[model samples]
Target: MRQIPTLAPLPARLPDSVPFVGPETLERQRGAPFAARLGANENGFGPSPRAIAAMQAEAGEVWKYGDPTNHDLRAAIAAHCGVTPAHVVVGEGIDTLLGLAVRLMVAQGDRVVSSEGGYPTFDFHVTGFGGELLRVPYRDDRQDPQALVARAVEIGARMVYLCNPDNPMGGWHPPEVIEAALAALPDDILLILDEAYAEFAPALPRIDPDDPRVLRMRTFSKAHGMAGARIGWAIGAPVMIRAFDRVRNHFGVNRIAQAGALAALADTAHLDRTVAQVAAARDRIAAIARDNGLTTLPSATNFVAVDCGGDGDFARAVLTALGDRGVFVRMPWVAPQNRCIRVSCGPAGALDAFAEALPHALAMARQGASGG
Candidate 1:
């Protein structure tokens, strides 16, 4: 018999889990590729032409490492935010930045606060770093900001996470509510404010950069339509920003991605156009759901959550039927919220596939319920 080395206590104790299964993995399992890809909240409109051009131009420079300091990109992000480069930290993406925040702020057994079925990746990060997670349930399908603050204080938490224009449910609170949450949070607890979908939701409020306890995360992945580029940045007080450097991968941001993200940031017209396209696609999705007798929640992000008019089992059956019919979509992992299936905005062709698939999927779900 062969012997293997043992993992450390934290890694060993943790179960093998992933935040989501990729579409490719699903295709492999089903022995077919999906006709419409809409599950992951990715922007299907794609990145700006200018950004694509910049990445193509920089393709030859892939032989060299990206700027370790991420100087120019950080400067551009700072300029956009009306802050200095010292307050910006560029990373591979918000996912990596989230992990970094967990590592730096959370020691083993420290308490962290988040929504019950919030962005699962953040929860994965917290647990991976050995932090104890306390979750507050959604109030009226939206994250209850006051409840989050109260939990943080009651538990003496080290960090709190809030996703503005949230995922899965696509619900958001007005800026004043977030401001109140910030005020209510204890001084020592850091608020990791994720604004990845901010471009699609104009009504949401942006926080002041001067606040030391708040770190706002932004991404080129959503409105800028550079998900493949894998680039994002965090804006916070200078001291908090610098702490990321201590544990972050020094050369993590690829050269081509940096070039693409910089160009994307410069092209405001492209961003505005993309946002409009997403809004239209969102409306189309809602209309299709209504046509099929399903209602949709108001969406601030690039996706809409369609209420299945049933329980979690019913929604799961609908999602499975969609998969079987070559349409890829997702749903929330927990109850009340899990009763809705999430659909991402895409080109007319993709949504057409979805529109074609929904009626058949509904039929299958209903039939299964009757034991047919």
Candidate 2:
């Protein structure tokens, strides 16, 4: 018998699992399309018209690869954020940039810190790079910045991950708290601040790009309503920004995405409108949850997390019942956090579907538990 090639130790040790199962996969599993697409925290408002136009204009030039340096987009992002171009590094999306950031900082067996139930993608990146993750639990449904810093210091962590207007719980810390946490962190450790949902939140005081201890990641995938476009940028000290280039895919960002991101950055009006719509949708979701005897966590992102009034298993049943009704949504992956199911902001039709299905879904879950 012929011997097969052996896998690398790191890859071999990992489980065959993805951080998220896309709705498309769920559709396949269910053998039917979901009636409401409100689970992935995507902007249902869609991309700005200006961005659509820009992508269309560039459609004919698909043959040309995007600028390897991502020059124009980086310049536009810098201007928008009041930072210099040297402070920006463009990538396919925050996910890719996160992977890059982790690779740049983590060595095998190096310790990292994050919330117990923080953004799974960041945790996935850390584990893939063989970094030991120390997860600090959320206090009162929000990431405990103080706990994170303490854990980082205790473990001598090389990196710490945070998400503002965080996913799953849709909670955030005040700017002062974030700044204090940053100040408390050890100089040797880098804080990877994922602000992918920043546009929907109140304007927070900016962290100085001169600070080498932090890397701020932002994206057009949220308030700009361009998740499919796959464009995100990182802001950091000039030296740290340049370091991403050493490991990033040279042509990772495509021509159309670059064009769309540039146009989206310039269209502040569309962004404002999208933010307003998301806010309205969030209110509608909260109202619906309240009417059904559930409660919603305050959200600064384009989604709301509805408390199912029970434990993780109860929320999981509710989530499952919603899926059976062709309404797709998600819940947190860990204990207390998993007591809520997340619903993304979307067009009126999508929310309407959610509103219609939720009561029946909850009823079904309760009935199932009561042996009805």
> Can you give the TM-score per candidate against the true fold?
0.98, 0.98
Q: Alpha carbon lDDT of residue 253, candidate 1?
A: 93
Cα lDDT of candidate 1 equals 0.92
For each candidate, the alpha-carbon lDDT, in order, equals: 0.92, 0.91
lDDT leader: 1
lDDT per residue for candidate 1 within 207-325, as digits (tens), equals 77878899999999988888878899999999999999899999999999999999999999999998899999999999999999999999899999999999999999999999999
Against the correct fold, how does model 2 do in TM-score?
0.98
lDDT: worst 10-residue window of model 2? 199-208
Return the TM-score for candidate 1, rounded to 2 decimals: 0.98
* lDDT for predicted candidate 2 compared with the true structure: 0.91
Candidate 2 local lDDT, residue 259: 95
State the lDDT of candidate 2 residue by residue for 1-372, as single tens digits: 999888888877977788999999999999999999999988889998999999999999999999999998888899999999999999999999999999999999999999998888888899999999999999999988888988999989999988887887888777898998898988899999889999887866468899999999999898888888888999999999989879999998989999999999999999989999999999999999999999999998999999999889889999999998889999999989999999999999999999999999899889877888
